[model samples]
Target: MDINLEMINLIKGEFDIHVLIELPQTMLHANIFDLNANLNEYDSLTSFWPVAGKWQLEYLEEYFSGCESVHFVIYKPGSKLDLIKTTYKVLKFINKHKFDYLQFDDFSARQAFLLPFLKLNKRLILSIHDPIPHGGEFEWKRSVIKKMFYGKAKAFITYSSFSKDLLRKTLGLDKQVVNLNLLPYTVFRKFLTHHTVEQERGYISFVGRLSQYKGIDLFIEALPTILKEFPDQKFMIAGRPAFGYAVDSSKLANMASSVSVMERHLSNQEIVDVISKSKLIVCPYLEATQSGVVMTAYALGCPVLVTNTGGLAESVLDNYTGMVAKAISSDAIAAKILDFLKLNLYQDMHAHITGDQLVSKLSSSNLETLSQIYI
Candidate 1:
């Protein structure tokens, strides 16, 4: 999304920090010429190109002109033309205005390649998001550190402490590592509101990318046992398969007669609606780092049942915000779900922990920490 004036105002007013966000397209088309002067032509195939280019250029100009401590959050990597253009634009801007820092979220991408171009600017933040399981223990870490060292990153940011620990202890780069939690504001504003009270629903919900590691099969396996005790209970699984992962719809369908599966990407509002409407949100992940889904459940005041893997427990206090099951076992997940069902603590806990209060606390902490870094 383009950084609007409202977002600019919010950053300036709330945190007293001036941010100049380089538009994505300006970086994308950095060196590509208007090859045919057909940049304005609405060709069915390439119509999106020029429009995106113009939009990004406009946003970049406005942002660079307005703010002093300019920061560019690069979303794409290794588009040579884009990288060259971005490097040129940034160099010119830095020479003209003296930018304090150039930050990148995906450090492994073009950031590494573009570092030599910006070697004059000593301030660079190279971040990484390890969203999947890395099987090799020490060897994988050594390689990651080697990459970071080559990248010349001043600061390194990651989503979880597990990965951070790999960078810190194994690579001995603790001084450079920073932990930045993912925000769930999109889900919060979409599904959660103070006005909505608890509603009774017969089914339990799971929303996220449907994959083997996500343990949807395990949830399916536990259904029969859960059905034995509570005959009326139903299971709802939402979200599509991860990109390039094989998804067997018939296999999922065969698991249970009462299962309701929505195999498509749900909008933020739809996700909130489903979670808010359900009795509980179940995260039966085989592995995870930190979960944006768990945070969404918490912010929506939906009681959660998560596995004791990764950073799931970090956000969920046992028997407080939600319940944590034993690691990677269907029976354990089932037991926790049954326990939460038996206790019926959904309403009481929901009333106790205010969503706005939690959101404000997280938002404030993030802003405070980020402000210190920016300054």
Candidate 2:
């Protein structure tokens, strides 16, 4: 680890402000990235971001105008020795000045181990994105870590009412829980296209990190039926696979002319090109708790269809910004996709979702409204 004693002294002087520590490579990073983009100056908030987000944050940092940040280097989760070493290094680094509060943008095992050593009077706040583990996550371990954080946190934030309700009703949360909508990932705006809804040229697409919980199989199951009805329609699957996929691509193997599959992760420009020009994107998740992908599609003025699971439907207004499938089954997904096409709803959503109108309604943080809570 490189130590910059002079840099530490400078940032240390800037402490005693609210510090939002965000986990890397997750929606939490995207959330802070979006909020930071809208900030006019370095006010009460000082944040810690991972080096992984440097690709986008570096571009934003120029106008960020000394809104101070500590970009910590982190090892990908799964190493206990590294977590222990990193925790101690962090303890020695910033334990000198007590902060106004530490808003944990997300929780992690490393934080669980470090919490007891912090004898400071700083208030602790946590944001809960998913109440439970997804398909292949280590439920026992993550649940233990979350339980520890839940007990220590003074307040909690949830991106959707559904998640808040679950924490209160299911987990029996005794802490004050505030619900807030996650801001759109404005970091992607740098690559946004000028494609209008009427001028869109991309085909039906699925864009996200693929996993079993995402239910990509359900959509693929319904595709043949869809292809039969509209053989000329092209479909693109653009995401890298993770945690073992539930679907078999062989079913779509013969439909090369109609379907295009890219089983790797997409770069920012690639994401923009695919989503900005898309006719509509479908999210066939078996379960979900809000979605950055839904918000990203809206940011790009693309229509979306989501299954009625968790907080996914909360991301869009049914039939207005986007539509929702009646059920999680293939038949339901196919029927809704058919409805969207036959009614021409896909071509009608741009005016409702583009520009500041949609951003103000959906993405605005209402800093004033939130000021009372953060403090």
Candidate 3:
């Protein structure tokens, strides 16, 4: 919500800031990607490029209430033909507007291909959320692919210092890098502040898109052991599965009655409600860059249990803001959960996570740093 705060501070009138979205309409509708499935609503500061249809355009117009400009450029999926279509549209827009700088939050192969063809008088900045993609890959191939996309940019932006170090090491770059600790999903603050689920403090919830790497199956495998001791403790799994992954109902069938699963897209409000009601949020990812889920949990004044992988553990302060699993193993994850629940670390974690000092640093100073980087 950097742009929103910028507007609130009367900074938008000082500099021309525009939002461009090269939306893959086909995939957006098909829900092929992790984040695209829930695009029915826009929660960010910048307005959406309504490439889907006029109705979406209208919705975005209303959604981006304080922003002035909202433009749309549509293309097919991420095939070769789709690249050509998207490049053509992007080129036309760049030529017409003639912006001084173009910043891309997506440093994918598709964007890398389209970068060379963008005939514009603009300095390109590649905002690398995950400097190195999560999971192990051949070092040479990883380096090659990263340099292919990132090498084309004039500068780079990383959301966390951990990502910046990883990017520098991966790309072997000496270029200018801007780092911000956490990116707040501040729009939820308004709604989340007004409403809380008022749930009874018992269920341990795992929320977010389900996938193999996300460790939902690991969570499940750990369930039997957890239920052995705290049989009354409920485990709730919320949110839709990752694009093509299946929810093996068989896994849940023979489990204790304390397990509850809701396998569908949850609305923004629904997510806030679930998190608000949760006694603890579990993110047992095998790998990750940064977690918006952890930030959300903090915003809702709920503690988290995250595996010590990538930037996931960086988002948490271990025994303070939340507990971290020592390893990705199910045994490790189960043990950590039991420790948090049984040891009664919630009050301290809640205090630390929702404290005024940390909250201001994450939301105010962190966001201001981001806005300054754009200029």
What is candidate 3's lDDT per residue for 166-250, written digit by digit as tens? 8777564556677766634444554564447455556789998876668788888888888888888888899877646656778
Q: Model-by-model lDDT, in order?
A: 0.59, 0.67, 0.67
Model 2 lDDT tens row, 144-206: 888788777777777777787887865454567777765556556666556532455558889
TM-score of candidate 2 relative to the true fold: 0.78
Best by TM-score: 2
lDDT (Cα, tens digit) per residue for candidate 1, span 1-375: 221332243345444333433334334332111112332232212222234455433333332243434444333333566556555655555456555665554533333444555654447765555534432223455456456543465666666677666566544443467665554423244344443445555569888776667777777777777777877787788886663444456655655567788887675456766777776888888777767677666656677788887766666768877889876788998888888778877776676444566556655665665665566
Candidate 3 segments exceeding 4 Å error? 1-15, 27-68, 76-89, 108-114, 119-122, 135-148, 189-196, 243-254, 363-375
lDDT of 3 at 108: 49
Residue 319 lDDT in candidate 2: 89
Pairs that clash in candidate 3: none
Off by over 4 Å in 1: 1-83, 94-96, 108-113, 120-122, 131-150, 180-188, 191-201, 246-256, 353-375
TM-score of 1: 0.70
TM-score, predicted candidate 3 vs. hidden true structure: 0.75
Considering only N, C-alpha and C atoms within 3 Å, which residue pairs clash in candidate 1? none
- TM-score winner between candidates 1 and 2: 2
Task: Please give the range of 10 consecutive residues that has the lowest summed lDDT in model 2.
Answer: 1-10
- After best superposition, candidate 3 residue 293: deviation in angstroms? 1.4
What C-alpha root-mean-square deviation, in Å, does candidate 3 show against the real structure?
Answer: 5.7
